[model samples]
Target: MAVTLTDVAARAGVSPATVSRVLNGNYPVADATRRRVEKAVRDLDYVVNAHARALLHATSGLVGVILNDIADPFFGAIARGIQATAAEMRRLVVLCSSSADSSSEFAYIEVLRRQRAEVVILVGAAPEDAAYRREMAGHVRGLRAQGARLVLCGRPAPNPHTAAASVSFDDLGGARALASHVVSLGHSAVAYVAGPEGRTTGTQRRLVFAKALSECGVSLDPALVVAGDFSRQSGVDAVRRLLASGASFTAVCCANDLMALGAMAALREAGLRVPEDVSVTGVDDVPSAQDVTPGLTTVRLPLEEAGRRSLALAFSGHDFGSPVVLPTELVVRSSVVAPSAASARRKLA
Candidate 1:
């Protein structure tokens, strides 16, 4: 016979009501009593039917995780961190990808609300449209009005205020550090291959790169700066565009690892040797960075910690503040080096 709640109750010498409370993490039950019920369930190998339990209690012990794209390593790392934390807290997770589309994001929010998630975490890539920002904020407010907590893992839209909790990193500082480091290596004419200009990560990194170059008395050649979606192909194309513009850059800095890797491939095919011919650097030290031949010289951000902090804020019920900024360190690898005097002479010529 299948074990039931009554069986557990009988083994623990408590009412089924007490077992329900302990299992649901709902009502306050004495530690001793809770332990006894848990032990009985374990002894009987009894598992609460999640569907039945949710139907009875109006909650499924589920948390909703909404993201623009789960495939992005940065967001993927965040999701993994959230999953680890949720496992410890005995919560279930439901993942939804919005693909950076406002309609898709709003749709997922509605679905999560209808599903009765206790909390909703949104891993948004900054959206460009102001109307969409307002729409997203309104949905978040509605969820709060219905008593569900909302947290943003990445950059939420700017302008329309969101009272929701947020966890983010210092894109500007991290990008500036990477760019400044390259410029210090005597690369005065450096090209920037930026991600989508509207997204926070892309915009902040590009802006910081510009600022850092300016501080070093080097101006980014407008022809050498190209912005595209954060894809490997975009990186390759951006580099091609830069080369075709007749600008001589001893170094190229990409916004992300994918772009950096792509830039490397493009350079290799064009018979240019990395670091030897042109120094290259990328952001986000993704797993591929360590595996790629020559290894990537890039900036490493604490992506996993960003995810964990997002969950912590949700659970702690913390109020809104400036987004959390994580420290970024530059990883020196075979991809970057001091420009050769020969390359330097080319710039002078």
Candidate 2:
């Protein structure tokens, strides 16, 4: 016998009306409750009636795109690519911003499911939580069962079995390359401005930076490592804390270009000159990185290309043999230079 609405409600521990509300998108539901219902739908392999399925199919030309922050150039570039690809296919993209909140992300997923999106693309760093991962996996499976594709862009695949495709940046290699470049500049002591903790992107970059430092025989100084939320303000605050700590360092490395801009501003306020008093590096060479005075030396992630490829993968409807890993390049610019003799001597002091 086919799974019924009653069976799904029983499996999710909710009333049938609640499951109906979640599936029909006619009423509001709590995030946790929505996830439970989605999970139950997937677990029971529930299928809507023929008439309901026909109605959903009739409304199909929508693709959903979720991002941490569309205001950030990093995500904006990807969104552009997604939009460009979508335009060619005569499909409309429903862009959703989660603002780095896991609950909001899940809620958006449910909304897209209710809309019966043809494809859903999730971009940016995902929260490192077991329960969230499990719920997301269920959502992916549920969406696929309903003829929608789920793609992860710049995020780790939550479940190998459920994700239709995954596209990720080479964050580890990029961070290692960046650190190596800074170390080669005769700067032994370097400070780090890391992205938010518990995020895979930030954690991977930080770990690789530390590993690179170790390989260069440089000591990992906890005092020099500061955490930020990949925001300009967070970068400013982190740099201020680093300065107040009085840790002597010749260079600072930021997880993203926005933070690098903030770090540069803070350094100037502290009466320091870029590359003269202190060198700085950043990841993700956003447009501003080049326009900023003394252009930022950083790692360049192919944001737009990654976005385009993700959409292509979604459109192709082919099973990806493996997750696509995009390459990152080390972009050397005026922001980085050999330490001044005075700064070098200060390192020895």
Candidate 3:
């Protein structure tokens, strides 16, 4: 017979609600009461089999991962790391793509919760929305009560007080480093290709990128800032708009390598040369960043390591109430250089 919550409560000499509180760690329970509940759980040998046994190398249940888009290389690299770790533990992984939609994200999360997945990792940054926050708060509470884990990858935790584990790259610092690099190369007039508006990741990077340039005595002209959805096509469209509007800039800073590559293509279409007619730089030093003609100057994010660490945090009894900010590095390549003589002449004109 399966040991129920009532049975565990009876053995602990407490009410079912008390046992729930202790197990969920949502409310303040006396240490003694918590110990009694834990002891009862051990005596029943019910909860341990679902979790502790897995720590002892028993094949665990399903681990779910919901990504913005599995097709994007950014998410693919992180999922690769997660798959590697899950494979070692002989666990089955369930992967889903949410198409970067909140409705889809919540639906998949609920489905995983019903499956009693060992852990569910959300691997995208949803746009900031009040309704979504309220829904996420409810999901966090529900996941806690189910004795399952919720991990946020590349997204902010609903609240710092919650037990949700999160790991993200240092996007602000990377933006700062990349901006400083562009400023140092003597390019004052710059265009910025940003990601979707209201996305926490894009907002954080865009704000810092502009501020860092200002601190270096360069004003990031608001007229030159364009929004993209972190896609090559969006980057192409943004550049075409700038060209049509006759925006004068010596360089363009893209939000990611894919966008930068597209920007390079658009510039070539306009009869301009990279680092000669204009310099270009991007964040996320993915593998293809260096494969282009001039090679992209980008920031290297530890994406795979983030996946591995997030999974480790799921099983380890560590307090993950706050986010873990991994470091980022600036990689210089042939794509960026001092403004060329012809570009300087045009800027002055």
Candidate 4:
């Protein structure tokens, strides 16, 4: 039997009329009550006769894009590409920001599924949670079954055989190249500031960096590896903690440009010169990377191209049977240099 409004009302501890009003948005409801009703609906997997609505409308004329943080340059660039392609196709783009929260991400996916969007694009890294992955895989299959296409940009596909499409960057290779470059610069004592743990991007990058260091015969100091969110402030705090630990390091590698900028700021405040007193490097050579004083040496990923490719794949209506992997290039700037004798002596002291 289909789950009815009365079931949702009973689960939410509200009347059937209250549940109807909350779902229809035709009557005022308390925020708490609305949240309860929504949770009940999601928990029950109630679709409210979505198939009937699909038959009546036949077309949503909308494409949905889900992003972690729209303000971040990385995400913003991808959004620009997606929006441009969507506008050219005359399909309105609806953007939803999850702010890197798993619950919010799932909620946005559910909302897009209910609207029967023509295409749904999910951008950015996902948390490494088994349950979440399974749930997302189910959601992807559900959307496809409903005649909606799903595209993953900068995110890994849940199942390789699924109908969903994906476009991803070579994160591990980029991280490995960056770390190898720093190691070649004659800096053995290097500090790494990685993105948040449990995130695929951060985990893969950090793992590759460690492997590169090991291959170069340099042991990674646990004290020098700091966990940080992908933000300027987190980078700043990571550096401060490294300094307080009195770990001797001549180079600091950040997972992203924003954190690298923060690390540079902290180093300067501590009276250190870039690539002179200590070298600093970053990944994701964003637009600001070149503008920053003593430009940041980093890895450049084709973010906009990935976005465009994802949208194109969605419109093609054919599964390519494999994801499109974009290449990454190392951008050498003024941020990295050989350790001078003076800096080497200071590190020893």
Best by lDDT: 2
> How high is the CA lDDT of each candidate model?
0.78, 0.87, 0.83, 0.85
TM-scores of the candidates in the order shown:
0.79, 0.91, 0.82, 0.86
Question: What is the overall TM-score of model 1 with all chains considered together?
Answer: 0.79
Clashing pairs for model 4 are none
Badly placed stretches (over 4 Å) of model 1 are 1-59, 157-160, 345-349
C-alpha lDDT (0 to 100) for residue 48 of candidate 2: 80
Model 1 lDDT per residue over 1-349, tens place: 8889999999999999998887767799876686577557645766678674444335456799988778878778889888988888898999998887766777777667657777888885776667767666667665664467778776754454777787777666776677777777778778889879777667777878788778778898878889967788888988887777767888988988999888998888888888788888888898898888788988888888887887778878574766666777778788888899866875666
Best by TM-score: 2
| Candidate 4: C-alpha lDDT | 0.85
lDDT string, candidate 4, 279-347, tens digits: 999888889999998999999999888888888889886655577889999999999999998789988
In candidate 3, what are the lDDT values of residues 205-275, reduced to their tens digit? 78878887888889888999999988898899999999889889999999887888889999999999998
RMSD of 1: 12.9
Please identify which of the two predictions, 1 or 3, would achieve the higher TM-score against the true structure.
3
Rank candidates by lDDT, best first.
Answer: 2, 4, 3, 1
RMSD of candidates 1 onward, in order: 12.9, 2.5, 9.0, 3.3
